[model samples]
Target: MKTDTVITKPLLEIDKSIDALVKQIELLSFVNPTNIEEEKARFFSSKYLTQPVFKYPDINFDRFKLHRKLFKQQIELIEDERIKNLYEDIIYTYSGLIKCIETIGSGKKFYYNSLHCFGTPTEIDVENAKYILHFEDEDLDSQAFAPKYNAKEAESFFRAYSEQYDFTYHIKHSDKISAIAMVSNNAKTLVLNTNHVYSDNEIAVLTNHEIGVHMVTTMNGLLHPLKIFSHGFPNNEETQEGLAVFAEYMSNNLTVTRLKELAYRVIAVNSLSKGYSFSKTFRLLHNQYDLEKEAAYYITVRAHRGGGFTKDYLYLTGLKKVYDYYHANKNLSLLLTGKVSLEYADDIESLIEKGLAVPAKHITDAYAENSNTNKTVDFILKNLK
Candidate 1:
């Protein structure tokens, strides 16, 4: 049997306090609009010319109190400079998220706040998106790509896939979510869009994408001596999203179609930087790029919702970074040590040495072997600018 690592008393207390405060501020809870389906209907009924009027859930916590409590932690008592610096950064990151939540739907205010938190895509990132768009998409009419499974069936598929690991998480259906599926880190639940019909390949794709890396990290983060791993490291979204998409690649489910979806996200987010409204971005994807209407609308909503969220653009950049890291034979397991960033591998190692962190309790099963057979997809990833 394994023994628990002993973390210092002061550090543990501060970590627990911060964790308690941070638990209430899950950004997804506030950012995902509560009226997605309604807004989508209105958008389509208006012949795709109207901007969506999104409604977000109210902030349930006292933001000022949360901020004060987070900053009042005795971080100075932590003797380790690296650990202290990390805690400070985490506090500021959480504060920034609070500001983001506060400014949602306030036009440029929220966009500027989002820019500070999740930056806009660079010129090279935009070029890479266009490069992927140049490739021919695979046949959508193929038997393997048929949409057959409903939300309940997808839940069953996910539950069965998750049986290989020793973790348990709730699966729920929602009409409000922007994606067909997403994992709630704090809630330990998978939220599936009630209206989506799943393809066999997409089931496999999401199984690895959501459960393989995301829920694996969620469970592993809980096993750590410090709660920061559970909350997240600063700027951890890019790494988390990259690992999830990489899981799809490793499992042989990543297709040119999927890559194009990510590429479209980059294009849509870049449109936000250019001040494109929802209809304009939708036209760029639908009319210019010939993406299907519903597909284009969701991508537009993802970018334009919350007044120009740029986080979607990170998925492609993150995939490129992780793909290179894997080829370089770096320690991918370290990145799996709970909502962590690649830049903080050294800090995670230091935490382990100090008995404040542990190796991931559950590893992404896809990482065990490379099953990808799509050479075209490989060529595209390798050639991304």
Candidate 2:
């Protein structure tokens, strides 16, 4: 063996640090099991109330204000874009934290509605050149997300979408959609758990917002030079969700009632986070907000049902930020370039023509051509002026 054999490993210490930082960033993507358990105990523990009460804690008042201060300091010290991106990530992360904390502490629920049968089709009986339509209802006896829908139809939907987008991978259809984006053994494909909790209006709003923007960005990012694009940009969910809700507004699908509903949800979820029972929150929205019991119940269930699911508050707050960006005429073409809403359909359409955000690769065909959708579209198109 040669005495002076050359070493192959890189000699850069900064590279090692960079690698370590990248690892830390990746770890931030998924929830930690220990932290999840601690959060669960904090919510479920009977001693939560008696232990201590936070009286307008500084942490509670401004979730990310401190984080922003810290970020500014870090940015001053760092020159690398990766490290800078980390600060941006932290800011977005803290925003969700603030909303969750506020939502949990609000002590109001029961305004959340668990509306059923949102995305599924309505049956029509035609007579004398007139079509009579009926919205379907969920069957309590069935454990399906929708009434009598099959995976075959789900396969068709995704397949058709794939063909339009000129790409195909794996897809799994499901009767149940676990909102948790975790390790699900059910199947490897994107699941469509379309039991109708949202309305036709809500469906259009979510479709553009969720599938159109969120899912579309997901797929388009996959086609990028970096595989991470598919994974989503850093701080993706906040941007994605905020953008999605904004799309609905751009398309003029976002209603005042929906906005107010999100506000109520923020209050409801915050109540649950602060240890209020479902009944108490339900009563709060019902009594204070003048929401009916059924409406209040849905809001409460969404907030309190899963015991500390304080994530719904982002809808309204996100909508506000997105709308503000739109009003300012920001580089929303980037916002529109993904599968997104026409929140400001006209503004978005301009970008689409320029090949920024692509047009929808898929529209729910079952409803797209229907009289109901046509009427809704017509109303929206007319009002756009």
Candidate 3:
């Protein structure tokens, strides 16, 4: 609406069609195993020797038909070459994701597909994880480390946090989520783990990480004329996860324990590339790394679920990139303008200029002030390879 050039009806129609198709393909909806609690109990009962068989949500949509429909779109009708290239990449990305979802629980087939979508952690990433693991954890006596709140209390906390923004989102409790908390973008819902307990600092972390950034972008994406903003750009996961974790850092809620957990994720993910099985990865984290059995099991589940999910490693890598970007005094708000990638900042600006996109409606509150006081955590982040 800001541009003088007339928007083409064909482009709008194509965009709308693509949006509708892509909305049905949210990877998180199917990526998480449906029987996590059952599998967890089984794995624990076996004393960490058994390889748990995880069951995933059924893919309701026809993948082949969806694929056909996606490619059927006449993207060539868009006059702008840059926009055309973006759409082309988006189609391929979504196509790859469909393959990932389709092959879930198919062992190495799913792992290879996952590798194609989200690459495995590199040698440097492993080193970074090892580096973080070398640091001593904070005092256990600290109130920030205590798990004193239940899922119901977390819902209340999230509800209160939601009051700060002019947006409405649902909060639901589930036992299926890998992480303790996550934001489902398409549904505009924040899903919390029903069985997990929350610490005060973790509540703050989730509020800013999930709602402040994830939900904020979810709403902001809906405001865009271009629905791709709402669905996501190609390889938007790293940037989105980076921004979410960075919000924790900015809010002063990021603890060394949390950073170590992310590091453990990198280690866990790296194990997959080495052909480690679920039990093997669990041993690597629990026996060699000295992580608690429950903690290690969950981390192992995150990596081994959906057959070698390497996406968890992105958090540390993304945090490093975003941290460097922030130190360089870059415009953080631009990156917050929906489920966007940092690499596409210029493209987003172009979209805004062409009246295809708009600026972020809600900025992350954590970005407003440098409230972080942990100099040790700062040193570790600054030194990450």
Report the number of the highest-lDDT candidate: 1
Model 1 per-residue lDDT tens digits across residues 51-151: 88899989899988988888899999887788889999998999989889888899899999999998999999999999998999876557778889999
Residue-level lDDT tens digits of model 3 in 10-95: 67788899888888888889989888889888888888889998889988999999899999989898888998889899889889
Q: Which ten residues in a row have the lowest lDDT in candidate 2?
A: 113-122
Candidate ordering by lDDT (highest first): 1, 3, 2
* RMSD for each of the candidates: 1.9, 13.8, 1.3
Model 1 C-alpha lDDT versus the unseen true structure? 0.90
TM-scores, each model vs. reference: 0.96, 0.47, 0.97
Against the hidden true structure, what lDDT does model 2 obtain?
0.41
Q: Name the lDDT value of residue 180 in candidate 2.
A: 19
Q: Go through the candidates in order and give each one's C-alpha lDDT.
A: 0.90, 0.41, 0.89
Residue range 270-385, candidate 2, lDDT tens digits: 66545676557767778876777656655665555323454465554445556566557655545434323333345345434533335444332222221222343233223321
Off by over 4 Å in 3: 4-7
Error of 1 at 172 (Å): 1.0
